[model samples]
Target: MSNKNINRLFEALTPTTEQNEKMFQNILAQSQNENTRRRGFAPVKRARSVVLAAVLMVCLTTTAFAAAYTGLDKTFLKFLSPVNNEQAEYLSNGAYMVDKQVANENGSLTIKQVIGDSNLTYILMNFTAPEGTVLNAARYRFGDSMITTDQDYQSIGFKVLDDGNPVDNKISLVMNIMTKNSIAGQTVNFRFKDLQAADPLPGIFETVIPGSWETAFKLDFKEYSNLYQIDQNITMFGYEALLNTISVSPISISLKIQSRSLKEINEAAGRLKEIGQNKYSDNYPITINYKDGSSETTSIFTGLHLLDYLNDQMLTIKTFEHVINDKEIASIVFFDKEIALN
Candidate 1:
């Protein structure tokens, strides 16, 4: 078949919005069922396991959409759906690629590319196990926590690389980190302690392989990101917040804001706190508006209260979902206010 025909076939197999949501709910359910085992570790692994299972199932049922994204180095394709031309155009601009490798007795890991801004860092890598080990459908559970040089940044989780069919003794993965400060020109040390591979089970992930993978690399955030100073203030949840900075990259956008009135502990200390219900407002919506009259929004906000007793200042970081061309943005709408960017 011709390349154009092949692309059409893959696009046809792509899941719709409802189908994607159903798959997401299934992944969530699987993760919840195994929450007992995922308490101490990061919540990303459970999600990854279910995603791997779902992807496997989809590949088996649908012809082979993975083949469409074979040579593309962008890791975003692995997570986002409907690999259409528009999505490809968003990531068409090449990233600063890296070819660093680290190995030990168990296996060798090669860092393919590094992309990020000050607020987030994404590492694209592939791992190759020793002769006897088979890594097909393998997921790792870390014994100790994954740490970085900057105490402010923490590893969110691992994203499995999509390579159509699982290759024997080989697996691709993406390491994502949420940063409290800029990681530009900073060396990050990664230690995957007591690494154990999960057995090829249906839902639950049982450890079968035991080992560790360690590597360190420096990040040049300036190479991939553009930092913009927004010194704007907006009020939300009955409190005022100062939008300090916004950083943009090819893969994501990160925002940092501060609020002095947002107290760490409210006076309603007697009642049990409600979960998943934002009573102050229906939802704290953060949107990124593009010049073309389109926008993207995310409600997930990470708020860190600092010096509550002394100054009562709260710091929050919001990471947007869509990959964008930073230069094309017209403004950013925080709640009701739209702060113009250009």
Candidate 2:
């Protein structure tokens, strides 16, 4: 997309001062917390063969959490959710790198790693079996001693290797675990109960949950300090849009934007819920450069919500995809100009 078009899309997200500050503080706290952490998961339980989905969390040291997939598939690793180059850096640098491989009769379960800020956590896993072993389905969940507000957290989610593609001996899995209610600083719990696998490919053959494959452990809510910012105000196509805050994460930017209005600001927004989180497909401008020397520009925005308070029409925005290449972003091109942030 043209720089002008991209900026126009990004300039739409505008958040209020309080909202901006809160977002900034939360990010800072997560980044600062990264400095204080130990990397090792204490396994609570072990399930057997083709059925090893549940993994409990335990605390451990960094030396014990090393990468083991050196000989494994790099192509598959890169494709796993949240395990891009930047995320790999995050795992090697600080996040607990769980490299425990539990053996099974027909295959094995490798708990790759787990990384978490105060708000969200991601788990990486790999399931390897005999060439013909058909790993069908799995379900898991995350819990803590303290439960955050229902709205603050999301249910555990997982994505298996190839998803709809055919099965293979070695496959990868990624998860998105959300949390709130002070879950960041505290040890969290997990469970992976049901795991099913079929044999000799899919047909009239019966499916079995395998002998066992459940585990438990605690994840040290290690803090991460990987946030960068680019604060500026610019006039795009005559309208003044303030780039109030640009928060960086392992793979993306946590952005906040705002514009001024004397009235209640988009009254249509007030009738519904949240800020710019509706079907109002408005375009904005943004450019991001990754540490890998790659960059992208897009006017597409998601994870957006419009929050209106008083006369302020603020919009919260984050990148629609894993646009940040470097764990530390190199630059952000805005207003048709190359600008370095962080």
Candidate 3:
């Protein structure tokens, strides 16, 4: 494949209509938490001040912005989806419309929501320590809570945020998990162990959080299946790339693309560098074209990073998942306008 071929491929890209743009924009905002900040603890005395500040934010942005957004207006989850070089094969395409809060022996834990696809499950939750409990005492870790289904499952990274520093002792987290099973709509266990802080740890926040806050429950969630499939090949900058799989659900979409060799990717990157092209690091420029002629310009949140290009011939495939579910999409315009998979 030559550069001429790549340019020709991208030239065939299609643009979308107007009305459908809003829908995709909303999805981008919701899923990416574009301008939303973390919901920290706010004291009543500070209520007025907070309200004023919020008002300013709304004024600067828009009234509709302030009125909208839920706890689902999260940022960490987006970062978690693809922090390092990992690819998320499947993620929950569930709307951020879940509120599963329950009380435990030591405190209360809210199962904010659960989302996943056939390959992985992401459980988001908030833990409130018992009254008069100073967090940071213990690590407040969750024991093995991966669902024990016929398929294999394992825990990845357990993240806990103490809102803003240590305000009202409310912590939020998105548990990173992976499994080789299809455990959707199945009752799975959610077990979190108590945190014993105030230990000799070498990280941030070295304080004791009093509590035996153990939370356990059976959570039921729905997993999305990508109904439409498209597999095609395009040689970009002399690299033969395979657009392996594309699955779209009501809430999210996933794309699995592979390349033949890493050398080609390296060469392609070099060529882009030579041409002064911007890098595709944090975000991907993707446009979803629906059947209604309305198209959405949203971003692509990455997941797991498959095989290495150097050691293996397989190229690193970018995983796509973001919050957006609306009318059925007809095709997608991507690869710098190089390809359109209908």
Clash count per candidate: 0, 47, 23
Count of clashes in candidate 1: 0
- Tell me the tens digit of each residue's lDDT in model 1 across 1-342: 234543564466666767767876777777666775766454587667767787668645654444333324634444433234544533333334567887888778787866566656667778777876766655654456466665543546565665555757777777766666657677877777554555443344545555666777777434345677887877665566677776666555656566665552233212323345432211344687888898876544432222233544433344433445567788878765787875
lDDT of 2 at 4: 41
- Deviating ranges (above 4 Å) for candidate 1: 1-97, 138-145, 196-205, 221-223, 264-283, 300-315, 320-322
Candidate 3, residue 93: how far the Cα is off, in Å: 12
Model 1: how far residue 158 lies from native, Å: 0.6
lDDT of 2 at 30: 50
- How far in Å is the alpha carbon of 338 misplaced in model 2? 7.4
Per-residue lDDT of candidate 3, residues 259-309 (tens digit): 656565555544212212322342333577866677766442334334345
- Per-model TM-score versus the true fold: 0.61, 0.45, 0.45
**Candidate 2, residues 58-108: lDDT per residue as tens digits?**
111211232321212332234423334335444345456567676667556
Q: Give the TM-score of candidate 2.
A: 0.45
Q: What is the lDDT of residue 206 in candidate 3?
A: 30
